[model samples]
Target: MSDSLKVGLPIKYALSYRHKPTADIFFPDSTYNFAPFELVSREYFPTVTNPKGSLDSAIYTLISFEVLSVQELSLPVFVRDNLDCTRVFAPIDYVRLQGTISASGEMDTMSLKKDTQVIPLSQQPNYPLIFLFIIGLSFLGVLTFWFFGTPIKRQIKLFRFKRRYDEYLRLFQRLSRATDDKKKGLENVEKAVILWKKYVERLENKPFTTFTTKEILDNLQDNRLSDALREIDATVYGGIYSKTTASSLNILQELAESLYRKHRQVLVQST
Candidate 1:
């Protein structure tokens, strides 16, 4: 027997007899009066024996029992042989077993203590890291705009201005070629001047579209712009028959080119 017995474990009990038995072996009724164990299996083995030329038969009984509960167990065992018509006390008088029901190993059932406490758990988001990541992205965006955004914007503005300037130059050339016809030359000059004013209004964010020719010249404070506009307006409105010379139109073109260059310089410096 082990020092400690685990519940549900089987314990074997065996007994051998010198003479053949008439009936199967069994525990007495008293054994079940307070049964705390189950009988799992029972077996009997018979053998012929020879002692000093005398032959006899012997029987051995083996019983397997499983412990059912935790308690101190004591049992008294008695056996009887039918051939002798006699009752005898078993060689083992008393069987004692003791153990606990509490879990001990992987195979044992789990037991809970009354005082055990359970703590609640929760997951929290890392707000600081998220905020830092957002700030880092914002700073990167600003730096990118500072380094590359300005140059791209300037290039686009210059391209649009150059296209408009080319259109004005072609119109001026047509006006100069129409010098032989006074009315036709004046009409082309009027169109070129109007187109130039509209482009300047857009580029400078000015009121050139609403301004009179005199007002435009005053706003610009350029003597060359004033003279050129006056000559074109005289031919268009005053019905003047005087032809516009190529030299006079070239002066106006130079003035427009100079103004475009000035505005472009301002854009580049601001970036």
Candidate 2:
């Protein structure tokens, strides 16, 4: 509504009756009951500031609008034909741009203002929902697993058994160093083997008591360990004979230690 909006056509016009353009943004209807605003650029509304007190700083004039649930802002823009109007985006609460002018010679046009009510559409999806069932099922599965599957246990390793096996391996080294005589050495070796079988039986939770000679030889492993153990039943029971020597006993003890260490290493690696 300022006089700056008006201009004059050139006498015998060079550009054929051109007019200057003017624009202003408003907060609400012309009842002047709401905040007044200025159009900064496009739809970005800069507030029409007023000092609240004598020594106060400027503050934005906030406006409230009652709109439907599914609503968005629509702005009614006004401009002369030659002047380019860059359409602007606005927030959900915004209403309209009204104070526009067309300036020709003595043509100060205070165009009547009208509001562009923003019909609120959903800020969410407009159509029917999909994949909701999938989401619900996933939640259900998680809850079921939490309540039931969490308590159920699967197969697990027995740590104590593994530790005992390691101790047995070390025991072989300790006991062999204290061992001295040859025939007595073989006797000690047989007793140590019996202790080992008992350890395995307890660890494996199986009844391995009173094993037969054929059973021991059948389960014999081809490691350095099997020399005295596997050969024992074959030598004593099967009438197969050989002289037990101090050198042989030392060699057998070393072989047993090597085999026991190797087997314990396998168990440790697995753990």
Candidate 3:
């Protein structure tokens, strides 16, 4: 490559390695020098930022790891970062690349227009690259529920949780309306509790639903559900509760609202 055609941000053609989602090494297309990846998660959308609280113009990669000791497994981690397409491409040879008009547009491939400068893969690294060098990265690491376990096994659990939230919302809405049939309304509330217990049993990776009303209420106490759950227990075990059947419905709807709000908060923070 000639120094005259020096590389910098916004290169002509940008190329990077992509590995198979399941394993670590590059797969058979072998044509792309791809690698296999163990997807602890497929929903990851990692981002990078700068020291002054501004995001870097370039994208970067950071490897997140947790070294746990029986004494202290959780520690601060600092390490090298991931590839930056803009900066990483600057030095590479790009004979043909669909061009970029502005700073934020996608990097596309165009027909080869000029003579190509072929460089051996081994020699490409001589150029400049921006990498992440950290002292401890684990502090900012968002350990998906998968890293502690496996997504394959936990997928059903997550699905059930999402569905239960939706169902709880619907059931609560149904309960909010005034129902003259008090007995049937209580029955509906009971079923909603059943549905919640079943979902919590799965989500907590335990038999929570089987824990009886008292036990379930105890477990959910810290989760901002104590009052509502107590009311639910009163309805189930006692002949009746202080709140009317419609009020019980209100409690159910309110509990669902609180949980869904929390779940959304978690998802937003994660993204």
lDDT of 2 by residue, 1-271 (tens): 1111111211110001112223332222233222223222222233333333111112222322332222223333223245565433222242332223533457534875768999888687634354776778899988877776523321123255456666876765555543344455545555554655665455435454566644644554434434655454444345443554223344444644554566555555652
Best-first order by TM-score: 1, 3, 2
Candidate 2: lDDT over CA atoms? 0.42
Off by over 4 Å in 2: 1-158, 182-187, 203-205, 220-227, 230-271
Global CA lDDT computed for model 3: 0.44
Ten-residue stretch with the least lDDT total in model 1: 54-63
TM-score of 3: 0.32
My TM-score estimates for the predictions, one after another, are 0.41, 0.27, 0.32
RMSD of each: 26.4, 20.7, 28.1
Residue pair clashes in candidate 1? none
Superposed by TM-score, candidate 2 places the C-alpha of residue 98 at a distance from the truth, in angstroms, of: 79
- Candidate 1's TM-score reads 0.41
Look at candidate 3 and tell me the lDDT of residue 223: 48
Colliding residue pairs in candidate 2: 70-120, 70-121, 71-120, 71-121, 72-120
Q: What's model 3's lDDT at 149?
A: 40
Clashes of each: 0, 5, 21
| Cα displacement (Å) at residue 21, model 2 | 99
